[model samples]
Each structure stands twice: as structure tokens, then as C-alpha cells.
Target: MSDTILTLTGVQADIAQYHILQGVDLAVPRGAVTMLLGRNGVGKTTTLRTIMGHLVARQGVIGFDGMDITARATSARARLGIGYVPENMGIFSDLTVEENMVLAAVSGRLLAERRDRIFAAFPPLRTFWTSDAGTLSGGQKQMLSIARAMAEDRKLYLIDEPTKGLAPAIISTMVAALRELKDGGASILLVEQNFAVARALGDHAAVMDDGRIVWSGEMSELADDAGLQERLMGLSMEGK
Candidate 1:
């Protein structure tokens, strides 16, 4: 197998007449957590959507596991082991947590062992199995979204804004859970606004500005460069 789990070369996408991504290039190494960081409205979420096939790429190549998936539909992409957790968490509000898990597991054809593993990794989800997904706390909902993806035995994940609107304690728990997923050899493409959370969990970092990737390198390098952070992320020591 190739070391690269996902690759995007000069990708361009548009939502209606508005072009969102212009020549965006990215790569997620196998079993690594690659973060996409930028200020709001920088097309970070759009890029993730393009990769998931929710928005088709008008140009460039999107290859997963060495196969070109640019034209594949969202369902086809999912069957290829690409899991997506959008910013909204994408859980069914009316469904119980257990029902949601069942739907994901059955749809993904996941084995019982994988289901057990997901529950083990996220005990809160197991605890709230009988509760409605919409009724759960923000952190619990995020956990459920991630757990559903894991239950699918996906090799690659597109996780957008995992910590948005979450409390500090809950954010910490989410970060720990992501770290655990990374350690278990799941390749992740994470879109995050929280630099602290990204620094704690990401192995590689890419900065997006005005619909293009401006900089990408080791996560530690971006964390240490305050100037870069301010210029690209609109973040400073005093906070945005």
C-alpha cells in the first residue's frame, strides 16, 4: 500500500457561481493527523466538502488509496472507506444514540469487534446509548459523531470543526479521543479553528487563505511562529 492515504492536486471547486477553492493542493499521509487551519471563511470547510464529494471538484485530482475519486459520488466515496463528520456533527436529532450507531454500523458493514472498539474508545457514547442525539451536550454530540464514523471501519476521515462551541473540559476530551484515533492508525484531515486543540493533536499543518493553501509543514513549526499564526490564522496571544 502507498504511504499516502489521500492526495489532492491543484483542486478547484465552486458552489454555484462562487468559486470557493482555487488550486488547493493537499495530502494526508497514511495514519497521520493532518490539520487544515485558517480564519473563518477561508474555504477550509469547502475543501473538506470537496474531498467528501458533497461538492465536486471542478479541476485537479482527488486520489484516495491511489485511486482517482474526483468524480465519485458521496456514497461511493464512503464505500471506499472515506468517513466524513461535518461541522454540524451530522447526527439524526430524533434518533437515540444506539439507533444512530446501529445505522452507521449496518451501513458501513462494520464487524462486531469494531463496534465494541468504538464504544470502548468513547465510553460516554456507550453511556448515552439510550439518549437522543439531539438531547446530548455539545461534547457528547461531537463524541457520538466521531464514534459513528469509527464504527464504519473507515481508513480516512474528514473531520471539520470538531471542537467548535465546546467547553474547555469537553474540548480536552475530544482532543484525547482524536489522539487515540490517530494512534490507532486512522488517517485524519481535520479542520479546526482552535490552535491549542490543533497543536495538541495534529501531526502536520496546512494554512489556507483566500481559497488556497499558503503554507504547510510540521505542526510544531506553525505553533512556534506567532507571526505566521497572526498573518494566516488571524490569531494572536491576546486572541482573535
Candidate 2:
């Protein structure tokens, strides 16, 4: 297997005639979390969508585990162990949490052992197993979303904005859950706006602006550079 689990080279994608990604070159190292950061509408989500095959890339190569998957369908990509948790969580509002997980599991069936492991990672999922997913709290719903992805074996997780609109306390739980996933050797490509969570969980970072990557480097390096943070992330110590 390649050291990099996922790679995108010169990727160009368009959404309804509006070019969102221009020559995006990126790599997600094996067993590490790569943070994708940018202001709203900068094509962060579009980049992920392209990878998931929700939107086709007009050009460039997308390699996963040493295979070129640029033209693969979304179902094929999922079967290849690419899990996705969209910003909306993508849960069936009318279904119970267990029902949702079962639907997402491998072959649409989750074994007891797998269920135990997922519940261990997110205890709230166990508590709300019988409850309608739509009735869960925002944080719990996020947990369920992640749990559903884990119901199947996955090599890479493409997660977008897991903490959006979440409280500090809830964000902390989500952060810890992600950290645990990383510790367990799950490679993640995360699109997040919370700098704190980005700094906390990211092993490497990529910053996007105007649909292109402006910076890519170590997470610690980005965390320590206030000037770079302001320039790339539009923030300062005073939270301007």
C-alpha cells in the first residue's frame, strides 16, 4: 500500500458551469487526519463531493489505495471502503438509530461485535438505539452519522463540518471521538471550520482559498503561526 492512502492531482471540477476546483493537488497520508480548511463557499465541500463521486471531476486523477478512481461511481467508491458523513448527517429522519446503522452496514447488516465496537466509540448511539434518528440531539445525531459510517469497514472517511452549529461541550465530545478514530488508524479527510478542533486532531493541514489550496503543511506549524493563521484563515488572537 502507498504511504498516502488518497491523492488528488490537478483535479478540476465544475458545479453547474461554475468551476469550483482548479488544479487541486492533495494527499491524505495513511492513518492520519488531514484537515481541509477554508472560508465558506471556497469549494471545500465541492472538493469532497468530487472525491465521493457526487460530482465528477472534469480533469485530473484521484487515486485511492494505489488505484485510480477518477471515474468510479459513488456506490463503487463506497464499496471500495470510502465512507462519507455529509454536513447534514444524512440520517433517515423517520428511522430508528439502529435502522439507520443497519442500512449503512456492510451488506446492509451489522454484526453484534461491530455494533458493540461502534457503541463503544459513541455511547450515545447505544442509548438512542431505539429512538428515531431525527429526534436525537445535534451532537447525538452527529454521533449516529459517524456510527453509521463505521457500521461497515472503511479505509477512509470523508467528513464535512461535523461541528457546525454544535456547542462547545458537544464539540469537545466530537473532537475526542475523532481523535479516538485516528488513534485506531482510521485515515480521515476532514473539512472543518473550528480552528481549535482542526489544530487538535489534524496531523497535517491544507488551507483552501478561492477554490484552490493556498497552504499545506504540518498542523502544528499552522497552529503556531498567528500571522499565517490570519492570512489563510482570517482570524487573530482577539477573534477578529
Candidate 3:
């Protein structure tokens, strides 16, 4: 088996007349949390969508677990052990939290043991099991989306903007949850704008600019270099 769980080589995609991903090349090593960091409109989210097959790639290759999945449908990709938690949190507002969990359970990807593990990781979810997802706060909804993804017995996850619009306390909770998932051997590709959160949870960091990766290396290196952080990510830690 390959050491990398997911690989994207020279991937390119377009949305109607707009070309989004331009020769995007990335790799997710097995059992690592890799953060995709970029400024707004830099195609970070597009790259995640392309990998999920939500937006078909016009060129390049996407491989999962040693299989070329560039042409596969989104559902096929999911069944192949790729889970996606989109930026919007993609939860059904009308459904109760339990119903949402049940819906993901029906995917049949998760074993009972896996379900228990996920619930254990997010105790807040257990408290709101019967509440309608829409009625829950933003943080709770984000938790539900992540819980649903975990319900799948997937090897890789593409999580986009997980802390967007969340309060600092909620963001901290999300970071803790991701760290727990990583400790449990889950490989995650996290798209994050929050540098602090990324530093807290990511092992590897990739910086994207104008639809291409400008820099990538160990998260520790990226975290300590304030000049690079300011230049590539427009982040400064002096205030923090």
C-alpha cells in the first residue's frame, strides 16, 4: 500500500467560464492532519470540492488508497472512504440531530464500534440528540456535520472552513475535536483561515495563492516564521 492515503497531481478544474484550480498538486500522507491555508478566493475550497468529485477535474489525477478516482462520482468517492464536511456544514435543517445521525448511519460505512467512538468524541452531540439541527447554534451544527462525517468508516476527510463564523470558544472546541480525531488515526485535510486553529491541530501546512500552492512544509516551521505567515497567509501572531 502507498504511504500516502490521498494524492492530487497537476489537478485543474473550472466552474463554467471561470478556471478555479490551476495545476493544483497536493498529497495527504496517511494518518496526518494536513492544513490547506490560503487567503479568500485562492481556490482552497475549490481544491477540496474537486477531490470530492463535486466538481469534475478537467485535468490531472486524483488517487485514493492507490486507486485513480479522478473520474469517479462523488458518492463513489465517499464509498471509497473519502468523507466531506463542506464549509456550509450541509446539515438538513428540518431533521433532528438523531435523524441526521441515522441518515449518515444508513450509508453503512460505519460499524457500531465506530459510531460509539464518534459519539464519545463529541459529547455535546449526545446532549442534543433529539433537537432539530436548524434550531441548534452554529457551533452545534458544525459539530453535527463533523459527527456525520465521522459516522462513515472513511480513511480521509476533507473539512472546509470548519471554524468560519464560529465564536472563539466554539473554535477551540472544534480544534480539540480535530485533535482527538487525529490521535485516533484519522487522516484529515483541513481548509482553514484561522492560523491559530491550524497551528493547534495541523501537522502539515500548505499555503495556496491565486489557485496554486505557494508554500508547504511542516506546520511547526510555518508557525514559527512570522514573515512567511504575513507574506503568504496575511497572519501575524504579535497580537496574540
RMSD of each: 2.3, 1.9, 2.1
* Candidate 3 off by > 4 Å: 109-115
Q: Considering TM-score, where higher is better, how would the candidates rank from best to worst?
A: 2, 3, 1
> TM-score of each candidate?
0.92, 0.95, 0.93
Q: For candidate 3, what is the lDDT?
A: 0.87
Clash pairs, model 1 backbone: none
TM-score attained by model 2? 0.95
Clashes of each: 0, 0, 0
Q: After superposition, how far is residue 120 of candidate 3 from its true place, in Å?
A: 3.0
**Residue pair clashes in candidate 3:** none
Cα-based lDDT at residue 212, candidate 3: 85
**Which tens-of-lDDT digit does each residue in 1-240 have in candidate 1?**
238899899999999999999999887889999999888898999999999999989999999998999999998988889989999889998999888887776373657787677777777877887888889988899989888888766889899999899889888878888888888888999998887888888889988998999998888888887887888777662232
Name the lDDT value of residue 159 in candidate 3: 99
Kindly indicate the candidate among 1 and 3 with the higher TM-score.
3
Number of the top-ranking candidate, with lDDT as the measure: 2
